[model samples]
Target: MSVYTQLTDDQFAAFCQSFGVSFARAIPITQGIKNSNWFIQTTDDTDGAPSYVFTLFEERPPADIEKMAVILNQLDGKLPVAAPLAVIESEAARTDNDKRYVIHYEDKAITLVPCLAGAHPEQTTQAMCHEIGAALALLHETLQALQPSEQYGVPLYPWSDVRDRESQFMPSDEAKLMRDIWHAYTQLPLATLPKGLCHLDMFADNTLWNLSLNNSQKGEARLTGLLDFTEVSAEHYVMDIAITINDFCTTWGDAEQGESVNFDRSKMAAFLQGYESKRPLGADEKRALPVMLAKAAVIFWLLRLNVIHYNRTEGRTGDNIMVKNPDLMKRLSAYHWSHVEKAQNTVFVLLNTHSNTDQNNQIVGVFSSITQAEQAREQLIRDQLTPDQLSNHSHFLIKEYTLDQLL
Candidate 1:
């Protein structure tokens, strides 16, 4: 969308010729926020398929972009990702002997990948959340197995940049809130949390879902693509989970100026359940979820503020295509911190019953309040358990856990 380096028809054709491809057309893709992208139609003489995506990196360095290619290449066939295509050098051409998959065009790293199928979901459903969670778990597990020598090298947060530019913008209430959240984030025990390769930004727009035409179950969608790994990095797994939940499991109220974000517990529960089905979360990760949620909000808020200030200071160019409101994350951070305890305090009630034939354990309910959970347990014991089972306190189990603990 952001055409930092505009290419003419002749230029594109020549570029394709170097890569053993015949170019048909190049249309700008306007949906993305970071790099400049083009939907390219090229004739693949071998297969006749002619869809591809061309990207011109705006901010990332050539080395980092090459690392991204390696990451994507490692993920090919394992996950639904569009990996960068290897460049084919002409036999007569003598250039840098580095076996890289990226091309330096207009002094920026450029890459071409197959255009993946499906579209980003406008509104993510519970089933979609579950599928995305499971897919993310698989991504983490697979990357861990690959054990790439070069770790994901993106910065976790741009705190220094934000701090440097804090005085450029006028101070406001939201600004004060952001400062407080940043201070709190600094105190978190991030080193002890589980670490993995994370898709730091798993927002709905970065994911594509394909729904079956004759689906037997209603509201089911399959994840067809996970795009835009420019923000991928090595970070806490729980922090990645928090970032995703903040986006996918939250609904926003329409506001012309500032949006109101509300977390959906049912959707979150389903997502965690799906995640645990693949890789179970640790106890430390469970206890750190609330703080991680606030941290994720803080990270995005600061990044948005930085983007706004950078564009203003440097003068908006075609490369500066994204400008998100900082107030939205400010409100979200405040909401999550203000209601942290309530969101974390959850309890599960399990009712155990045994017959002469077999033993059965059932999760009767989960409640936010211990009193409600205890009441449900008492009712279940009185109605479903026998006198002998009631005398011995072995049949009913009421366990208290934070929202993350349920994962």
Candidate 2:
């Protein structure tokens, strides 16, 4: 919700006019960090006309923003994404003829999209996590058709910039943790990891959930919208999964100074189950998840620190902006790294074991916790057998094994 440039009513009206949209009013959306967004209300000329979200790209280049629009356009009908609208010259002008979706307003790329329904969940349920996981998998699968290039590929992190600053001010404990994690990260078989389009930031704030009419009775929430694809890029799909899990599965407890991070293994299991339902994670992906989680934590920590440092240097101390606490990420990184071995010990549900043939052993699911594995096994057994057949081969084995063991 950073408004770098302010627009008046007339300016907004003209901007809308250029796109052949009738604008009534624009209300500032004060939630995001990267772009300035406005919830625009329009006259109800059409009975079911959708509300619009106007965005001014603050940091990203116009060319990059254009590419993002193309990506969104590609995902328009397939996913529940707020794809950027095609700009119309006038009432008679055809939007199909024009490839340009963004317009230069005050030298910043500005575009409008139909605001998706539903609200961001404050506390995500296991079902919600499952929905998001499946959605992300679908997003990755859908975006595989695109060719990668420097402009449209993975965005480079300012690791050197952050490292230089960290050397000057980082505490000894935090420094050691970062070094250890970075060292381990470098040793990972990154070249062999599956690469695809990743939403890099699928935190709770960026996701929207809707409660159905029977939601109260069923106690379930449905994922309706996934917002903010500005950080979308081609990267390791597992890394993206780790990034998402770190946000959605981790819970925070209140403390005197800061909150304590606790990775909810059940939620993690549910998310992975949902993800695997769409696209099964490879053995390499499962093994690298802990390191990727730590890497994600470090990346965010560095990013937040850089943001704070730059803001202080630029003398924008009192500005209204969403500033994340780097210390939280710092603590989280240390925690994940320290518990890497434990976190990597996933539960494999062996549903059907062929006679002395290890390769023919049908594994039903991989879960983060033994409890989740047992539950899945129970459900599988229940589905397969009736009350009369329940006495025959209803037993399932839940084995705790590191990802490497499975490989």
Candidate 2 per-residue C-alpha lDDT over 101-198 given as tens digits, one digit per residue, 9 for 90 to 100: 88996668888888888887767677777888898888888888777634465476667678767756777877878888888888899999998778
Instruction: State every prediction's TM-score relative to the real structure.
Output: 0.78, 0.81
Q: Residues 293-390, candidate 1: write the lDDT tens digits.
A: 77788778777777776667767765337567777776778877765545446555555544333556565677654433544555566577778776
TM-score of 1: 0.78
Strongest candidate by TM-score:
2
Q: What lDDT would candidate 1 get against the real structure?
A: 0.72
Overlapping backbone residue pairs in candidate 1 total 0
Q: After superposition, how far is residue 69 of candidate 1 from its true place, in Å?
A: 0.8
> In model 1, what are the clashing residue pairs, if there are any?
none
